[model samples]
Target: MDRLHARYPFLDAARAAVDEADVDLAALVRSGGPAVDRGVGRVESAIETGDVGEPRRVRAELLSYPVARVVVSLVDDPRLTDAYARAEARTAHERFVDDVEGSTPVSLPEGIDLGRLLAEFELAAAVDVGVSVGVDEDRCTVDVGPYLRLASGLEGEEWRLVARDLDGGRVPVEREELYVLLREAVRERVLAGLPLSVPEPVAETLEPEVERVARSLSDYELPRSVTAELTPAAFPPCVEALIERARSGEELPDRSAFSLVAFLAGAGADPETTAAVTGLDPEAVAYRHERLAGENGADYPSPSCAVMQAYGDCVPVEKRDERCERVDHPLNYYATAVEEVSRSEP
Candidate 1:
């Protein structure tokens, strides 16, 4: 693989290059060599930091991106997927920024050039790269539609339409600002092909690496988010049981974790706060609640007790009380408990 493929493996050309090399990804996984090792490290580093650790041997580094994807899909955790995708995108944006600022048409040797990068995402027609910095200091003007598609989810007010310079139909952005939107585009591309169907041999072969990354995420400290102000005392017995285990750093089963998060969210806790309190992966939590959210902004209810019981998510009989017997679902138990708790106060 070339250095450019190693740097931006999400590009279509990178995939085509791998096809040209006739590399058997399944064979790479079974071999458990540099590509697999670096693949695991790439994800671990993403959760711990924000980028795949650093440059390594070109071929191994390029192959590791797909290996990491399979490992992530095998793990099948939205949190891990989001984490890995962000790390890849972050690394690409940084490398592309260097390419943008550090290269000229002739001096460039390795890595993707700016024109090709935009064209890969079909943004060539949308991004006007020609601009006089002496006058506008704007690096480029992105058509309003493409800019909004990529920048709408960005965190800052500056990304908002009202905060931008809009003329006719384009949004002018600085050089670094363009890099940020491209980062989002990269993230979207990486996510588009995730959760690939892994061959049985490859899945079994990569199991250890998958387990390691899973444990890393489970053990990783909360990065940052608003904590939900919650009353555990008012929680239903079953949810309280799960929350206690989560707070103690035990990784709950997927169904159990989803139930707890959905319940807390339905109770008015945002994803960040729920993740903060329950040790759920923030990205997973955000994606879950976002997917299940209504147009009016309400979260769907957690799985009912029967579904939880079938999934073996219900707490043992000892954890329940008379209220639990009376109520059919966890949320119902919570409402009763919260109402009673409020009444018992002064």
Candidate 2:
């Protein structure tokens, strides 16, 4: 137990709080029902056992209470922890948005209360709203790219911006509505597996910027073209769909080419035919097949057939083997090709 205490700093404080009754632990329960005294028994049970396991579990349960809710329950609620979490999220998003906008903190229409919008969503722990805006030179477009973290399961951040006609405000064109639109505008450039900025260790750090963009967008009331220039954001359309479905516990289609190929092979697709369709070399196709076979507990049909199945391309294994013989290792050729291609590209 002492060893566990030394490892986890929070356990000691949590134990002290529970022992002294200094904290109104009941106030931390989920808001769905009548006051449930689950914590008191749980804490007592853990302390009686004197086993390290109980304390660890108890600490986790206590911390699971949303920081905001915890503050509300406390008498002299210092919203320090909750406020810091929100600030961290906002700063990360701002850094991302700034990178997208060429470092010009993209401002929104005057009177669009971004701070309030974020507060509303933060308190709710999730946000789903709409904004309409038009394009201009300075605030030409409001980028939602920074808000990706919020949209996923972490804090449930999502928005749809529909463009309204200036005259009649009809024929709404939602900025994030179309697949191809997001693919070309946001996905292709930014968010293509790029790492977050220094301040953004986690998704929460970008929350503020996301809120700013969301609120500022409500005023423009016109559909504007926004750019997606980040690496991880390279596939905004696909990423968004995946995120939404994942949040709802739904399965999305396999989009990665490699994963798709693996899926088809596992489902019992013929190797030779699959290779031709996928344009992969025969041996490569068989390698994937072998992997799937191992996972499925099936015998490899044939090494040659497996090769053909794995490659999923027109190239024969015989020719590939000849090519492989020239290189010290099979990967050497691939590495050299990658380098050459990178160097040759603009």
Candidate 3:
């Protein structure tokens, strides 16, 4: 149970809700009517005994909002964390939008409200909405508005548009729809707990609002202190390169990102310091550190050059020498570098 709580942070809240009877699990599922009534009874029994298996089955049968409400009552269950998180994030986003619109002076870019644009980006990132933008010569095409349909597993007409200069005469109907779709995509991903990347043009336009939303969320916190001796110069070339790329706001591959986090934790960097060093979200750094320390156990070594290369992060120059090949891990390189520097100095 402790391990489960560590693995799923939301479980604590769910479990508490169930124990306190904060929500009526039976009535919540009853909205699904007679066909799901039996499943609801089983879910209530499971919740009372902390038997996740039965409730999970009920969850599968009652896939609609009614079941989600019941599942949400059991805060300790991971079966519906995604649904719960999405709902909470959406509500937060709505409040954020209202705050932004009510206080700030709104501007319009290409007939779209700036506040709305920022909201869209926030939602997109939180929800993992998928939108692709492609460039062909002067025109940029964006695929839009498939997130809901995709989530429902329904086939829908493809929505797309070619980007054009809005100031250059009448905008095509598809282009207008494209703008709306673009916002929707951005909003979805913002809420989806996924890394977000936007075109430079779009980023520049949304800079202020983006910063505001991110600051408001404060998703990551700074480290109080760095435990290890700060030695950037002694770091392996691969690690140094990753740090630089992260600072420059490049979205690292998932493998590389996790490897960096694990290495930082193993090297005795606290979560906040790790976040600063890697330019990752603070909360994310903390979570990764916790996972590495708890589940993976301490002493996880930094990945070798070969593994780095597999993640598209290997610096070719670092591998030019046979010495680099002999090094078992990035930490070894750092150790060797520090030793050589110490020997040469005194």
Candidate 4:
């Protein structure tokens, strides 16, 4: 648990939030009575109207009450506002980049002056530029920090500075766009708070009353132990494609890599098993597993298909056997497959 906390320091607050009994929504709402109802009504109205700024204000007001925080999450409704969901997910991605950049430092390749590159794009005057380059085996990747978009805007096109391998293909870069993206994430984290792993008795009591609001919480019910037995045949096409690429020593997009790791971890695969399946580094897989796990040892669900597609990881295939459209999250495929296998055995 200490190791898990050390690795995912961001989740410490979430762990604490879940453990506290005072966070129970029913109790809070019952105590607050009319005030809580009025607040919920206002937030719901803001959500229905798609008022961007209003939700933030509502979220702020609701933060004092743990139940109200979950109410805010439900009312904000990521499914209703896909743009909002994407933004939140993007923030998660940026945080991943920040973590990677802080831990792994890479030197820029010789003769590649970042200043000169910025000057070439007329972005030198706009912002301070810093470059962190990572090299794995023969592949080289470059991260131009958060200012790439600013630079791109100045250039008037989608201009990006990429590090190329000897063969001239794009490689991985740990881009920290935190400065630009952190505000919403911080707000969402505060508003939604962390999902607690409610015990079966507690969950049963709250489920009927807070069912809609509960769905807005992060996945908190995933088992600690590997319960679902997965087979290679049951692997989703997208996951299979990812595994094939990983095996061939290809770099995956950060979001895809994250989704794969989270999916494997949530589906009861141990770190070593996850690494073996995805061809990712064992240590990296282990860290990712721990990061996704909640205080009660349940793992979070994988990012949904929309997130995967937004990150360009969703490969469109012609005449696919499985209905990808039916699957929402990547883990859904695994979960469904496990159920199907179990039913067939009986």
Candidate 5:
């Protein structure tokens, strides 16, 4: 007990809190030696004055003693937020032990309070879960938390909540599906000794969607003109492609195919730059576009073109296109591209 205070002072208050508990909870010791009683008395006196220093010091001392930790952990029940108050008082001890056991040992200076650590974890959980968490005198709301979003296969949120709950000693067996996925993902990435950091449950939930979009872009090249505006996070496919190419010592499909197709569809590019970027003579790129247009015989209508058609503004540019009209031409081209791509698939 003395060793713990020297190492971690917050546990003093924790032990004090447990000792002062008037309730007949099994986690506390009803009576003990003068040493224990003195420790509790000192801590309780401090709590009455809002200082908690005496108890804080005692709690810190109790850290070296595992029996104290077990008792402290049991004070908070998972089902009720009211239990958070009890848990809060014990959290510093928990963190101190966890930190000591983890690869990173926490060495807190004197005067560091346990309440701060308790609030920090709760706030972090609230933010990471994208839920609104607030606690008042006796009411706490977790409505915006993971469980609220399960209607959309937002199992990721639920998974994260379960992990938090489990850590807090509140296990919800019904969330086994989420727990399994989280456990699998964690073990797969962590146990393999991978360099990647563990992703939050929110991020894991969106992993499939991100990967799906990325795979769609595996063969689909990005346009040079828009490359500056697009970032890896925004275009997960491009990022994945780049990463895979680097790992395999292979090149991804060039931007030329995409650029050429767009140009053929009437999205012209500057002559010099297109030639340089594609490694094709400027004339060749232009000729290919012309050839495609000639074969398709409709200049591969753009969305703007479709918009113009919809608005009956299908007048030829040579005849004078309007400057003020909105065109769905881009949408038409997009639809056509989708159709062409689908049909091209063998």
Candidate 6:
């Protein structure tokens, strides 16, 4: 596989490289090895940590992208789709940003350049390159249509057109904002034509990978209400799992740790309580608790079900309940579940 293809498996050139190699998915999955492992890892890591982990082997990395697409297709969940696309876009953004700024050493001299990336998204005509303008080194204009389309999902009052620095048919933006818009474009491009058709033979070959990812979609069960009562029995399954892991004092993955601490902090659990459950250094846990309070000025919300599931912080499918279906957010589930526990105790 070409090095560029391994770096960006979504590219047409990458696809062509795969085709030229005659590496069939069915055969590859059946045989199984580094490529398949990396492929499964890509989807799982994206959902869990929000990026396909660092590139390891060239062939494995390139092949893994296709494997990941196939698995995501077989799994066929919109949450996974959203998570996977976001992760891919986020990952691409990091690489592209480093390359554009000339900070990170280039692994491939001809990887996706800014000009081609903009042109690929058909935004080349719409975006005014800042340096090319020969005046301001930090500002550029994006056509209204592309700007609106790309920045639709962006939050904050600053993203609004009325608040924007508009010049004729274009909206002025800084270099950083330009990258943010490009990230959205990358997400949309990656999300085009997804949940591809997986033939029975190929599907059968990829059953294990499908089973693993599909199960991740179910972040376990438990109803909501009264998240601050300090009742372990009232916690949702996903939270319970995190607590279990945290109590071991072994550091959980970043997402899992955030879910645990955030959920506990929201539940009116004190720093001491968090330390006790997590069994980590009391000072460290207390410091995190203080930071959380300072950062949000209140309890940070426990990650939502879709987010939890995507992050793999949620438990297996078999643990999910009807309440999991009824409730959209972890806080909501805890509210009801904690109420039930409180009432039953009295």
> How many steric clashes between backbone atoms does each model show?
0, 46, 27, 0, 29, 13
lDDT of 4: 0.46
Q: lDDT score of model 3?
A: 0.43
Candidate 4 weakest lDDT stretch, 10 residues: 150-159
Report RMSD (Å) for each prediction in the order shown: 13.0, 22.8, 19.4, 14.7, 25.7, 12.4
TM-score of each: 0.65, 0.18, 0.32, 0.42, 0.18, 0.65
Could you tell me which 10 consecutive residues in candidate 3 have the lowest summed lDDT? 216-225
What's the C-alpha lDDT at position 46 in model 4?
A: 32
Q: Write the per-residue lDDT of candidate 1 for residues 1-346, one digit (tens) a residue.
A: 6777777788887899888999888777877888888888888898888789987887988888888888888988765777788889998888778776764522324546667888999998998865532446446889999998888556434777889879989898887888898998998888886789888988887887888888887665312111235667877777877878888989787667767777777666878778887887889888767644442122134666777788787888987788877666666666667768879999
Query: Residues 1-346, candidate 3, lDDT per residue (tens digit)?
Result: 2322211113223245344545444443434443244333333333232222222322233332233233333222332332233433333334334433456633322222333443434433322212222423223232223433222211112321133333232222233333444433432432243223333553443344334333422221111112356567777667777888888999887677877876666456778888988889898777656555222222223455567777777777744455456565565565566667778895
Q: Which residue window of length 10 is worst by lDDT in model 2?
A: 221-230
Q: Give the TM-score of candidate 3.
A: 0.32
Per-residue CA lDDT of candidate 5, range 1-346, in tens?
Answer: 3443444333334445445644232222333333334333322322232121333344434532222222212221111111122222333334443553356655554333223332423322422211222323222222334332321222222334435444333233332233232222222221122122322442343344334333432222211122121122221222233333434544323332333334323333344544443455467556544433322212222223333344343444454333213222333233334445558779
> After aligning candidate 6 to the native by TM-score, how far in Å is the CA of 206 from where it should be?
1.2
Pairs of colliding residues, candidate 1? none
User: Model 4, 210-273: lDDT tens per residue?
Assistant: 5543343323211122346557676667778778888888887666777777666666677888
Identify the runs in model 6 with alpha carbons over 4 angstroms from their true place.
Answer: 220-346
List the candidate numbers ranked by lDDT, top first.
Answer: 6, 1, 4, 3, 5, 2
User: Candidate 6: global Cα-lDDT?
Assistant: 0.76
Model 2 compared with the native: what TM-score? 0.18
Superposed by TM-score, candidate 3 places the C-alpha of residue 175 at a distance from the truth, in angstroms, of 51
